[model samples]
Target: MLKSSLNIKVDRRDAKLVMAHFYVAFIALLVGGLAGLLQVLVRSGKFELPAGIGYYQILTVHGVVLGLVLTTFFIMGFQLAAVSKTAGTFTNKQRTIGWIGFWIMTIGTVAAAVMILLNEASVLYTFYAPLQAHFVFYLGLTLVVVGSWAVGTTIILKYAEWRRANPGQPSPLLTFMALVNTMMWTVATIGVAATVLIQLLPWSLGLVETVNVGVSRTLFWYFGHPLVYFWLLPAYMAWYVMIPKIIGGKIFSDSLARMSFILFLLFSIPVGFHHQLLEPGIDPAWKFLQVVLTFLVVIPSLMTAFSLFATFESYGRSQGATGLFGWLKKLPWKDARFTVPFIGMLAFIPAGAGGIVNASHQMNQVVHNTVWVTGHFHLTVATAVVLTFFGVSFWLVPHLTGRKLTKKMNKLALIQGYLWAIGMTFMSGAMHAAGLLGAPRRSSFSEYGGAAQAAEWIPYQIAQAVGGSILFIAIILMLYIFVNLAFFAPKGEEEFPVGEAANQTEKAPMVFENWKLWLGITVLLILFAYTIPFIDLIKNAPPGAQGYKLW
Candidate 1:
């Protein structure tokens, strides 16, 4: 069985390396969560910063650590473990390369964190040029990105070697998805690499007198929107490949899952222009093109939803559940792993709908730069992505450490997931409502006692603060669960929930495995989508703007 294959023992070196990434990632969550709690309270007019600990400063910490640091490290660690376990042992050389990458990223993270803590780099995580951070901050982030490339390179090389060794056999599901995710990341990071190395770092260091703000933003969005997918695809991997088997069901269609990943790779990058729809000088035609592509990207998610529900129905029928909706009850709600991702997926339904609103040019004008955008992404990256990470860690940490997660602890983790969902309902719901009343995002305070329009935002801000408090408590509970699983549980091995289609004979087509072809299509789409817009941005660009230390 696939589950037994997943339990195959890995060398301690690879396990330790993966665990190291998890440790740093969790520490980021802790620090970032604390900052989040402070941000909400301050915005509510309920708390004031101690002098020198500024809001933007803490916001930068929250974004960089939670968004960039935690995601990068955790994905690298998760993919490495996936490839190794699913394919075979990582050669000693591969482990060395991975460790080298990990250390470089760690050094970069430390450098950036120190700069932020010292209040020298308060430009915020978007690091929109024109508002510059210390040169080292850019350099450190560049290194973090480069380090990820190193780790991604390891995955690619290992997959190639795997293909050669296995000859005609299909790559294992987890390994296949991990490799695809790596390829997509490598493709996406090119935009950011060009932005940082060519533009921001030079501007920050004063090597360039100015950098074109429009061009810089164009480059950033090229990477930025796809970065959302980078955060998401791993969680999607869990939903598609792992969840069904965990809950005693089979993957509805392996080929459908493979197609979705391929679709994402092809459509995800080209569509990032949707983020820039409201920005000036860019052609409306180009924005419309991206809008169309954005809608195309939604198809795969619909496929996934259908596939998952079919899996549930099939399982429920087997369990003697009668009619419509009965299947939902038959799901493994008692299992923390299943319950956590299930809730995360449910959150994505509305989150995806909000994204559609943002992508539509006319609708976007209504909520652009408002707190509604903040509300949308919280349901996505914060709840869907972060909660999924927490769920995977419940088993992953124990699996890596060769320990058991106690049943009581499992119950607590499930509770933690519910708490997160409840908190997000309060926070994101209020943000959406207030944003409709014209509340802005990225502002330290929205409540101005004299402005009645601003006064409309006060109650919502307070609700956000309360919700954030609950979220903080949930994060603490997650950390406690993770630590206990890692260090205190009894020695045992955990099985991976690797599902198969109900129809055993339904093999994926050969095209699904054609990486070179898919990679080619991915490149072509990027060129088609970005080349003209980027050219326009650079050619008509107003004289580049000088850096302002605007924190």
Candidate 2:
């Protein structure tokens, strides 16, 4: 007897509710992409979108809006689905709160973007410096983060509600991932939130005369870099659990997916200073510790990448796409189902490779504060992360609206993914070379004047510009598809499927829980960070050793 294929027809109302976040996320991407193009234009020394204010403000806006806001909003959608699926739980009340959170965060984010465009907060997304923003920018950012926390709270409580209702069985994989990531978010956001809410707000408001720059920067990344993981984990979840189901395969290892999510939750915090590799820190020991553990953080990511590839490879070979790497070509590339997602991970690997190199102590010095830094993270956060949101949206709209995506737009979306990966890789490569040849990021015009690649870099910048243009247009095509599904496409009265109808349900009985494993490992790393530095501080004490700045 042969196994039959499942034709998943998910809940119409539920599907649309889930898909709405993607449209908003795409809109945010469009806004950010415009800012990115402008920043590149100004960087290329060809055109300044606006005089005087220049690149700083535009880059700042682009970075925060696209990098943080868009990604977070989209992930919240995953969280929503998880809550509903696990315990058969969905609440109009909590879902209402979720929508409110989106609007609040979006408004706050847009307000911050406007401030950046007005040249009020050129402090960049890191917003560190002798430079500061208008209090409003900081306030806007705070509200955005707060609103996001609202979504997180809704997710966590909803998961709990599901668990209570379900009693003994494991929650769905999607719910499990969401619960764990939100828990991580709660832990990770605290330090930065405390610094911002308690210190930066008062100081920026002029209620306080001064605050410690060193301490604030320390606290910020303590909350910040883990922030990157919060955004990336959803993409990882999609890669692991969601994509497998979409591609008609069970997760290679359901237990392994749980472990990966758990690892992300536990270790994603406490590994902050890889971003601050060049900046002054609590101690060399601290920086060194983060550098080492950054490699550890890479493990779960690598695991997911490999597992996803292997699972897909198995499916492809089963379908007769045989031998070595030949299975890669047999994947169902035309179904927005497959193609939209495949390259997001494809782009992620090189971006992560750049990240690992950039995080190393020695290489960090070479690229710190340079365009290479910009390009590398652009590939990771903006390209790979955001593309996941877009890809998932494309995969989902048909189910939601009950219409098929036209083959024309499907091809366009696939082409868009290719353009994004190819364009960003070469663009980032040029940026890395320019950085090696010595070019500072965040500067409008080249202080280098006339270096060799400085001239050649023009074409790469043009490539990025063209890539962004295509990406922007691809996003429009996505919107059109979703709209057609929602309104124009004939409504299907056919009953939707339930149970295993979702992107992923939980694996049975995970003992590794991977969180415990990650925590054990991370504690050792943190011990390495704090113990030696504190011991040194004690031994080197003059009068007030606690007052020592180890830089």
Instruction: Report the alpha-carbon TM-score of model 1 versus the true structure.
Output: 0.97
Scored against the true structure, residue 33 in model 2 reaches a CA lDDT of 72
The total of clashing pairs for model 2 equals 3
Measured with C-alpha atoms, the lDDT of residue 14 in candidate 2 is 45
- Model 2: residues >4 Å from true position, as ranges? 1-20, 51-53, 401-403, 446-507, 510-551
Candidate 1 residues 1-551, lDDT tens each?
12233436555778898999999999999999999999999989879898769999998999899989999999999888888787777888888888889999999999999999999899887888777889898889989988898888888878888778766666777888898889889888888889899988887787778777877887888888889999999998888878888988889988888889889888889887788888887898999998999899899989988998888899999999987888788888899999998899999999999999999999999999999999998999999999889888988888899987779989999999999999999999988998888898888773464677887898999999989999999999999998899899899987756677787887778687897799999899889987898888777776434322322
Clashing pairs in 2: 172-506, 173-505, 173-506
CA lDDT of each prediction against the hidden true structure: 0.86, 0.67
C-alpha TM-scores of all predictions: 0.97, 0.85
RMSD of 1: 2.3
